[model samples]
Target: MKFRILLLFAVAFLLLTTTRLRVHAQSGKSAARPNIIFIFSDDHAYQAIGAYGNKFAKTPNIDRIAKEGALLNNNLVTNSICGPSRATLLTGKYSHTNGYKRNDRTRFDTNQTLFPETLRQSGYQTAWIGKMHLNSLPKGFDYWNILPGQGNYYNPDFISQPNDTTRYKGYVSDIITKFSTDWLDKRDNSKPFFLIVGHKATHREWLPDLQDLGAYDNVNFPLPSTFYDDYKGREAAKQQDMTIEKTMRLKQDLKVDADYDKDWTYNRFDPEQKKVFKAYYDKISKEPAEKKLTGKALTEWKYQRYLKDYLSTANSLDRNIGKLLDYLDKSGLAKNTVVIYASDQGFYMGEHGWFDKRFIYEESLKTPFVIRYPGVIKPGSKVDDLVLNIDWAPTVLNIAGVKIPSDIQGKSFFPLLNGTKATAKVPWRKEAYYHYYEFPEPHHVFPHFGIRTDRYKLAYFYNGADSWELYDLKTDPTEIANIYGSKGSEAITADLKVKLKQLMNQYQDKEALQILAGAKK
Candidate 1:
């Protein structure tokens, strides 16, 4: 009887020891894998963020991320459109490779490998909340609640798994923030998570929340210096229909003489919401008709109205960001979480008389990127190296210590943030590739593919028009002067063309190569 009692005690002690060891191992693993929150907004330009030098822009939350971590100044995109840019971000590949080139009639090819799937397979909880512009439903996320196609700003409908959609009352930005925090609260405590907080603010036909309406009314935005670009040597610029003078509709864009009841966007608002919205816009709508403004005066008026509405809409987006940051801090997740802020792509805020973003020009090419990883990234560090949207997926994977797939075209810039002695010596890319395919439909901007080096840009407009444009970015930062065939510029132009062809080959862009060959002929 004494021997049996001693044996039982020994077994119980062994079991307890093993349990503690297992728990300790699990806790260590969780500590190694930090949570990632990617806040991606639509059409938010780099120039509009306060950290990027927009004095009047009220983006304190986004600015806080910059102050705390790194701001990537030269972050560009593979394609400068909505759906395609999102696809590139997910796959870490270009639009052509992902088979999602244009926003219309394009379904994301889910058969291809996605970074989220990699993360999930590696034991991370993955979820996406808010605007997912991809036509198809999400595939790899453990949980997803997304807006239905360019989601309405008011009383938006959200689609969850198994084809369930529920209408939620409140502004879209606020609703997204609520859903994001709610998910974080309910996520599995044992595993680290990756969440994409997508926002649909500041898109076309900008509509602000009731509180944010007329927020920027008093400040008259100055017109861009190139607002009246004559399209001197740029054929594509001449052909685009995104100009403020002709393309902007006073009634639709500026809310001048708007039919709120009949318009679909305004109809989404409840009676009280509509009343408040109408009260503010009604004051501005009367002026255009009363003054009989036309031509340049009318165009400038439209530009001011556009800026006000766009910035006002952005106010809600910024506020929601603050909400997320506060949640991280309050919940004790800030220390072990990586927070990143970026836009789908850059938008033109009256730059070169354009409003939409389809050009490979400077304004449209560069998007805003700010990241905060508490202990890893130094506060107020700025990365001026060339980084593309495609690199986003690989970078996130690297942050979580997951292996980036070899098929992904983008190289991770994780070394730029990790500050490890080994990774600090790793080299970064010197150039970026860009392609814009949606054309002659919504914006009349021709299809083009280009390469941007540190100090030069070379683009070839194809399909509707065949032309080559080259700009020495050092001398012509605005890209107003094209010196493709200039006498003294021949050597630099030839070198850029060679580099462009090499980039096309590197990316396996067969279509671009064929177009380049045709141009040569």
Candidate 2:
């Protein structure tokens, strides 16, 4: 009797949905299988979005998506680095499982089930149009035109498959968005489409769009309290390679033709380009290069550089996102299409006196996640349940009615959109597990793993420094205080530590366990 009633309810719901869809369809509105557009940005912090409560950066289009659909406050990356995060998202697996853990790491195995590949198999057109930084060339797609690793902001070279590699002399943001829009503009109308638009903006040693270099020149930005952090509290955090004062490059880091050592590591520049580059920095610096900027002044300099460059890069992407959204509505794909905006990993923006992203800190741990699936999702909704980047593929597949592969580690959060609480609310991993493997290069972030519960977070730094740092998110969200050995929280710490171990084992992260244990000893 119960089964019959449930079946009847399902039939009735489908009938009502079809009726509504038909009404819209006949009135010059098309109701077809939803198109999926994932707009991904690079090294953008979760705190930088205006909708995410960043009073500093302005991201209107991203906010528009949040307002139109839902804002997932608790989205996290499996691995906090760029390539690993992207791999996890693609394979719905952890770094160990996916086997791509860092920038120079191995490629994500193409044999792994990918959402795009699944979509293609299900009769959807799949195209990737922009920066895809996997160690291996992009796989599992019909069309791809991607920039080589850490693509240039100017005169970037793109490797379009069928082996057509070419250089385009323009801003990376403009080119990426243009090509993405072009793909959409030329997609087959017979089948639904899944497009991945990845941007290489807001990455290291910030470079602003030429038009945006002077946007915030006059504004004296405030410095984070930890701006001059001397690696005081946690020994593990202090030894990182991602300091704004240290890792952040000066005029020479960016290609400016001036004096000083003209060598920019990780960036290639012509020998003759030195004079113009140094002169650019000389003009931009508010104070003479030799003069030391101390206290708040130094902090403000970093903030200004960060804001101007990051925002400038973001500006083009935002306008492009607006372009895509406009295309959906105008092309009559809006209501049925699902649009998502996210980042591979979160970056640090003056918080904790850092610039790069790698640590499991809040700024770097959480990435921006926005979704817009018109008919099924409530406009302007928000969810606070913890969501992992790995789960994104599963959710995409679920929405498209594709089978979630057994190999995928993360489960779908589609229930959250169906007006139901996150299935993870109960018996779901009460704590999130994280790991960072890349050592020395880029950001000398120590390899670590830990768990983040709703109210507290405990991380175990392995290798050089073996200890745990616990933070009460409710009482101290800034993470200024580490009460790892504090009294009265031992039981909670112990419990969380056990949960962390269990999660590690469950995720085939026995390696992290061995490291954590060694570090603890």
Candidate 3:
């Protein structure tokens, strides 16, 4: 009886070993060529993620990305506008260096040796799945993307490369994820792959999936004390077009059925939405503009609408991210592939009484950066070093063994990932230099330049004139009080001005002279 039992155990052990070998063999994933996937979302703020200290935003999958890898607590961008930010990500250069400082600026020059182009040369099958808000067509990527101008919430159209544009009939978030996962399924397995999965959620006129429309409607969100900012000491912050009270869209724009003139709808009307509105308005009832929405009630209504719509959009995107992660594990690609989740730039969610980005404040200055490289990064490690968006290209290039271009302004942070060094320590930019140039835009944000160190930040807003705003970040994390002209601030401002100029020169910025010349006072 004992011999019989031993025989049974031996057979079972052999079977288990054989099964494991067969599973590994049949998976067909390469151990050497690591797949890199960048999941980039639009205007998705760091503070909204569960891992990033947002007490309320439901982002289980985004939080998982951080759990499985490292979370960058101090990520920043050279220029915070959408187009310029994309350019910086692609080229690893600042907006001025990349020649894409303004939304109105021309397309990125393809003449340079882009990271994807290098990866393509190295035989990686690269594909971009969605939302390249590029004014000029994409280049250098092995798979070119076709997304909506800003992408849409429903019935999104994706134009494929070599002249293949297909309209997918579904929500934008799902469509992008499906296409990306589908691409992953059918990719040339002979070569490793790099895919950029971009989402159109949480952008301007935040819309949600049909399932998420009524979320956060019951719980009344507390009003920001700065919500009713009179703009007393903030000369430039007052001129911004991101105020929740001023620039936020209402009614049809927000997908809310309300008693207001439909003509006043603020969101960019989709061609399909126009048709729906015309048919509804021509046959059905029109909402009159004579609605008496008193002060507090009106503001609360807007806040509810904003949270319900915005969080709903985030829900879809996070759900889709989960789908991709599942694919990695189920397909046995988790061990080799590297996954990165980030936003184009940080966004304002009623922080400092604002919604849109393009400010040097904490909400807009800091973006969410999470990465999962199964072997290299330990689970749930958080790094609080200032990293620029441009650093992304070089970091990927370093991981892939492709050389970084001398002209690129960014250095790779790959070493920091493996717990080798402090990211912002070695080539330690004493302070990060930032510039925003799209003025009178959809958000009339004036052009500005600033410097941020470990504790202090100084900014100059010049809308053809000159105005300076300084903040002691340690005391005033909210930036409600600008101490630029305050007495006893001259010494710190002067020190920050010198560091700013030195950085601008290091970055080859010609505009740094403007700051230095104005600092003579």
Backbone clashes, each candidate? 0, 11, 0
Highest TM-score against the true fold, candidate: 1
**Global lDDT of model 3:** 0.77
Scored by CA lDDT, what does every candidate get? Answer: 0.89, 0.78, 0.77
Model number with the top lDDT: 1
TM-score to native of every candidate shown: 0.93, 0.88, 0.86
Candidate 1 lDDT tens digits, 426-509: 777777888889978898899999999899998999986788999988988988999888889888888888888899999999
Candidate 1 Cα misplacement greater than 4 A, ranges = 1-31, 420-424
TM-score of 1: 0.93
Q: For candidate 2, lDDT tens digit of each residue in 1-521?
A: 99999999999999999998866433322356678899998988778888899776668999999999999999998788888888887888998988887778565677777778888999989998888888567777888999888788766899997878899866788888889878878878888888899888777656666555556556666677776666556888888876666666555433323244433432433443334444556666646354577756654665667666676667766777887788788878787889999999888877888787777779889999999888677888888888898899998887777788898999988777656454335334467888888876767677778899999999877767677789999998888789888889889988988898899888988788677666652
| Total clashes for model 3 | 0
What ranking emerges by lDDT with the best candidate at the front? Answer: 1, 2, 3
Sorted on TM-score, best first, the list reads 1, 2, 3
Which of the two candidates, 2 or 3, achieves a greater TM-score against the reference? 2
